[model samples]
Target: MVVDDSAVVRGLIAKWLGDDPAVEVVATASNGEMALKNLAAADPEIVVLDIEMPVMDGLTALPKILEHSSEIQVLMSSTLTKRNAEISMRALSMGAADYVSKPESTREVTTSLSFQQELVGKVVNLAAARRLQKGGKVYKAGKSSSLNEDILPQVSSRGAIAKRKMSSTLPRIIGVGSSTGGPQALLKFLNSVKDELRLPILITQHMPPAFTNILAEHLARASGLPCKQAEDGDVIHTGHVYVAPGDYHMIVVNEGGKKIIRLNQDPPVNFCRPAVDPLFASLAGTFGSAVLGVILTGMGHDGLKGSQDIVDAGGTIIAQDEATSIVWGMPGAVSQAGLCSAVLPLDDIGAKVIDITTGEAL
Candidate 1:
């Protein structure tokens, strides 16, 4: 279903999405109220919801839609603005699957082939993930860890993990990559810790400029840690969280014997700028065996090769298990490729990091 007040915008989006073979335009509505009225008939598995409308806004309609069905995935859409970006992130944290910044005008939307493809891609990927999740193992948070339910993942035949010895030197930098369910997952992971480990953490979450700024603030409040968007030439420091700004790949280089961040507008990898691959590659080069790469919930295999770099440099990789991820593509790719040393649930990752820093080996 598509929900927006503007008929032109809605029509354009519907046309763009309907052109894709994998997607079907089940319904279109002028407002959230209309969407809610016809939702059951349409039976939309995914909703492209606009943030602002006359009758009911996306934020107002979000929870109601979720209440109507737990399986429906809501993707927030809005023009590029700071306030809209903030609300988009909020919607994601509130259970929306993802968000896309809409074009400013009908003319722009007509010309933006990339935007059209991106919208189609997100919808298709989300639908495939949803299908994979049906009747699969579903592990809710706070479940009892009975022996059969929560045992340590063992060395499988793929054996990428078994090939490397644990790093002799403790990891000096923690590199994290996430998307989709990342905002809430990251908050939970950070809140699980309380200042025990003091390594400089560099994170690359798929978010835009103003949204990344808000996300950094949210991270600081959640973890009680210093968090900021990475700026070019900013010195990396212990006990601080540096997030990659949107559209820029954050890389590290040694200058004056100290590590600092460098941002670039290089072409996106895996359809994302500030991609996990570049950051992980840089972490592998700058910190070598002293790097710990973590792959969290995401839509694609953005971190697979970079995770290999982390492990090949004698560092380690940890991944969030599929049951706890919104979309397990990134983590699952590395896990299946045997690049990860430990594949644990989201709630367990923070504590695992602290343990590893305190001399525990994978």
Candidate 2:
């Protein structure tokens, strides 16, 4: 289903999606109210919702759509702005599956190849996952260890785990990477570990300008930690959280026996500027075995090679398992590549991080 206040925007998106044989444009609504009224009849597996709309907004409609059908996936759409990003993150926390940042100019909807690809890709993946879930062949959140082999064979393969002696030394720094469902996941994980952690935490979440600032504020409120967007040459301090600013690649550099952040615009990796790879690889070089790397829910393999660098440096890598991930592409890639030390569910990841850092358990 496509829900938006503008008829032209709705038609454009519907037409674009209609060209793809992998998806069917089941329904289109002018507003949230209209969407809910016709939702039962359309019974769509996925909903493409616009954040700002008349009569009702995406945020208000999101939970209602999910309440109508627990299996339905809602993908919020918004222009690249701080307010929309904040709302989108809230929507994810409210049970929306994921979100897409729409082009500011409506004309770009047809002209921009990246926008079209991202929209179609997320819809297809979410729909496919919903179908598998309805068929009783998918893993639910908090059930990573119970993953069905036929659904995720790589997750069941014992050979995927690297053989390394668990480190007893506490980590000096923590590096985390996430996308898609990252905001909510980051909030939850950070809140859970805030009281126990003393190490500086660095995060690379796929976001645009202004959004990262809002995300940092949200993280600070949720985790009770001083979190802010990284600035060039900013000193890395213990117990502080730094978020990679939008459109900039954040990397850690050692200078004069101190760590500092370096932000650059040296092209994008894996189609993302604030990608996970550079941060992870840089941390591997600086902290080596004393770094704790985490790969969380995301839509691509951005963190795979960087995770390998960490593992090869004798550092430990932990991934959020498929069951709890909104899209398991990042973590799944790391897990399948035989790089992760632990593949755990979202609920257990925070505790596991604390345990690893405290040398309490693997």
Candidate 3:
């Protein structure tokens, strides 16, 4: 289903999604109220909702829609303004599956290839994940996660962690990579163990400039820690979070015996600026065995090579389990490649990270 105040926008979205043989647009509505009225009848697995509407905006309708059915995936859409970016970030925290930035002009909207691709890709990925999550069966496992052979979904519960040995020394820094359902997942992960975090944190979430800024604010609020966008030459310290600014791949360098943040606008890696590869690789080289790399829910395998770097450097990695990830592509890749020391669900990742960094995983 597609919901927006503009008929053209709704029609365009439906048309784009319709062009894909794998997708079907079940319904369309002019606003949130109308969308709610048609919700049950539409029975849509995903809803692309516009943020600003005449009666009941996206923010007002998000929780109601989730309450109607938590299984239903909601994609919040709006022009990428500062205000909309903030609301979109808020919507993610409120249970939205993901968000797409709309083009600002009518001409741009009609001609924007990126917009069409992003919207369609998200819908397709989210729908597939929803089906997998709904149908995946979790079974009991014996001891080691390495021995579990269940391939359709997650093999076992939290106890069935990857059997790889953890790093002997405590991690000096933490580098995390996430996309898609990243904002909400990041909040949940950090909120669970913020009080016990012993090292500085670096994050490379797949977001544009405006959204990344808002995400930093939300992270600070969620974890009760100082969080800011990484600036060139800035020194990362304990208990602070530095997010990669949009369109810049943030890497850490050792200067004057301190770890300093560096930003570059080189061509995007894996089609993502501030890509996870650079951050993870840099951490791997700098911290060596003391690096802790975390791969979270995302659309693609951007962090795969970098995770390998971590593994080769004797660092530890913990990937989010497929059952808990929104797309499970990135983490799934790392998990399948045997790069992670533990494969955990979203809820358990925070505590698990804390345990490893605190030497409890030994």
Candidate 4:
């Protein structure tokens, strides 16, 4: 099943998946409601979901799909944006298997060159993983202790947490890379920390244009921090958050006496325009030991090389633990490569970041 409001998008996805002999383009819907209706009958083995649409969007349809058919694997199709990235991340938390970013929404059907290959591969693997009844186990990196649900710290309430002091004044930069389950995770982490956060934050979430502005607005509302799409010549300053825009690569470069943000429209690395490698690589070169690279819940290995870059530069790297991740591919890669400084669950990540930032631990 393919659920997208755009007829062109639906048709193009249908055509691409149709090429697989092991899979069939079972159904296509212009919106979530229609998709649900079709799903009631088709009982598709897998669903390709689009994040935005009229009348019951993907975010709303996500749980319904899982409730109606727990076995149905869903692969989300999302545009690049801070908000969409958040919603896509929400879908994953609600049980989406993985997601792909569609650069444009038009009848002419222009997409990133690797769109078909990447999307099809994710669908096939997701379908297989679901059929295997693995439950998030497909993303477990190189086998460790089989995780129990207790790995994630339980919060007493939505806004309840033990308060801790920001202890250190290290001149450091925070680099966060997320994909499928990033937005919600990011919000939770950012909001949990105090408004007077001390370090500068740089982010590369899989997203496209127009959405970054919306995301920054949303994050500002939630985290009380100034967040915006990083401009090419913008100066990097403490207490601010800079997000990598869609369709461009964001990197940090030092000029004169200060480090500034730089944007590039070059070809994608690891098939991602705002690939984590460029940002991490640049930070490794610029900040060296004064960087803390974090790879969070996401699909694929975009941040793996970046983790290596940070580690080699004498910086610390943190990976989100598998049980709390929407998809563990990115973090898993870093963990498997032994490039991590710590592996933590979602609830504990914020506290850990604060600890590292301030050099105080509770």
Candidate 5:
């Protein structure tokens, strides 16, 4: 289902989506009220909802839509702006699956290759997840043992964790990578561990400039910690959280016997400028065995190579389990590669981090 006030925009999205044989444009509506009226007949698995609309807006309609059908996945669409970013983040917390920054001009949306790809890709992925849920085969954390063997042969349950002695040296820094469902997961993790964190934390969330800035603000408020977008020459400090700014690769460098943040616009890695690989690799070089790397829910395998570097450097890597992730791609890649020391559900991740850092567990 596609919901937008402009008929042109609706037609454009519908046409683009129609081109993909894998997806079916079941319904279209100009407002939230019309969309609700068509819900039972359309029975869409995924809904592309515009943030600004007549009768009712995306933020107002989000929870109501979900209430109508708990299985429906709503993807909020909005023009890139600080207000939209804030609303989109709120939508995610309120049960919207994900969000996309649409081009300001509706006419240009269909013609833009990047926009088309992002829209189509998210629809396909979210729709498939809904199908999996309907078929009773959806993945869940702590229940990996019950997953279909053919679909996830490489996945291991918590009981299968490899035995290894944790280093006596505690982690001096923590690094996190996430995409897709990152905002909600980050909020939960940060809020849980903020009081126990003893070192500065670095986060690489796939987002653009305005959105990243807003995300840092939202995180700071949620976690009650000092969180901000990383600056080029800022010195790393304990008990602060730094988020990688958009369109730049954030890495750490040791200068004058102190670790400092470095932002680079040097080409993208894994099709992401603020990619996780660079951050993990840099941390590997700086802290070696004293670094803790976390891989969270995301759409692709961006963190796999960087996680390998962390493991090779004797650093500990923990991944969010498939069941708990919105999309299990990033963490799944690391888990499949047999690199993570622990594969935990989202709820357990914070406690586990505290245990590892406090010398209570490996």
Candidate 6:
């Protein structure tokens, strides 16, 4: 199944899916509501969804699909915009499995035989690994994530953690970079922490422009914090999470010892606008030993160099363990490079942050 407003996109994706011999393109829809209506007839094994549409958008439809067909696996697509990046992440939180960037234009759309074959292969692989639980019936298009409390790191659940406070009085900030399984994990982490967390937070979740506003709304609702896409020359503040918009690079600058946020229209870094490296690099320069870089679940190694930069600046770094990650590439790369101070699972990550940052447990 494919759900998109653009006929061109629908046709192209449907054509691409058709190329897979083992798979079938059962249905397509122009909006989320139509997609839901089609579900009874199509009974598709996998759904490729778009974020923007009339009547119902992908994020809203995501939870509905899970509620109706727990077996259905949805993969979202969006334009390469900051808003899209944020919304796509929110959809993932609501239970959509994975996502891909739509080719920004027809000219950029891959038509080469090799690229087509590779695209088909990636889709097939992802579809095969999806799984979900609905109405007590378990169905999977892919492997199910063993999200369990037992999998968390060795830490007491007594509501308080014992740790020594950092001796240095340097100002600290938290930098988070995520893609793939980010939205849900981020929401869970942020919401789990107490409101008294001290440092300002910066995030660069992989997404496009229009979706970012939607993402911010969802994150704000879930985490009880002000979340928005970063604007040029915006000042970084504590108790807020500033997400980098899609199609732009976000960097932190120091102006008389206060941190300032800057957005750049420069070419994408590591094939990603809002690439993790620039933000991390900026942190290395601005906060140095006072920065705590965290690499979460995502594909690719966008944050690797940035993590290295933070480490070189005498800052700390953390990575989500492979088991808790949907795609372990980013965190795995940072861990392999020996740049991570802690390699903890997703559930343990929030506690660790509270312990390290506030010098107290939540």
Could you say which candidate leads in lDDT? 3
Estimate every model's Cα lDDT from 0 to 1: 0.81, 0.83, 0.84, 0.74, 0.83, 0.73
lDDT of 1 by residue, 216-333 (tens): 8778876788889999999999888899998899988888999999999999988788799999999999989999888988777788889999898989889998778877778877
Model 2: lDDT to the true structure: 0.83
Query: Which residue window of length 10 is worst by lDDT in model 1?
Result: 144-153
Residues 125-159, model 4: lDDT tens digits: 55533332234233232221222222221211223
What tens digits encode model 6's per-residue C-alpha lDDT throughout 92-175? 887676777766665556554543453455456444333211112222323322222121122112232222223242438999
* TM-score, per-candidate, Cα-based: 0.84, 0.86, 0.88, 0.72, 0.87, 0.69
Please identify model 4 stretches exceeding 4 Å from their true place.
3-16, 22-45, 50-59, 66-122, 125-171, 194-196
| lDDT order of candidates, top first | 3, 5, 2, 1, 4, 6
Best by TM-score: 3
| Clash-forming residue pairs, model 4 | 80-207, 80-208, 81-207, 81-208, 168-358
Q: State which candidate, 2 or 5, has the greater TM-score.
A: 5
Candidate rank order under TM-score: 3, 5, 2, 1, 4, 6
Query: Which 10 consecutive positions of candidate 3 have the poorest summed lDDT?
Result: 143-152
Give the local distance difference test score of model 5. Answer: 0.83
Better of 3 and 6 by lDDT: 3
Task: Report residue 326 deviation for candidate 6 (angstroms).
Answer: 2.0
CA-only RMSD, every prediction:
7.8, 5.8, 6.6, 8.3, 5.5, 8.4
Cα lDDT for residue 356, candidate 6? 73
| Pairs in clash, predicted candidate 3 | none
Question: Which model, 1 or 4, shows the larger TM-score?
Answer: 1
Residues 51-151 of candidate 5 have per-residue lDDT tens digits of 99989888888888999997788899998777888998888767677887899886677567887777876786665544442343443533332222232
The digit string of per-residue lDDT tens for model 3 on 1-362 reads 99988878889999998887667799999889999999999999899999999978989989999999967889999998888888899999887889999998767888999999889877765665555555653222332121122222232232333446787878999999998789999899888778898799999999888778889988998789889988999998998899999999999989899999999998999879989999999998888989999999886688889989988999988999877887777887778777888888899999899998899888
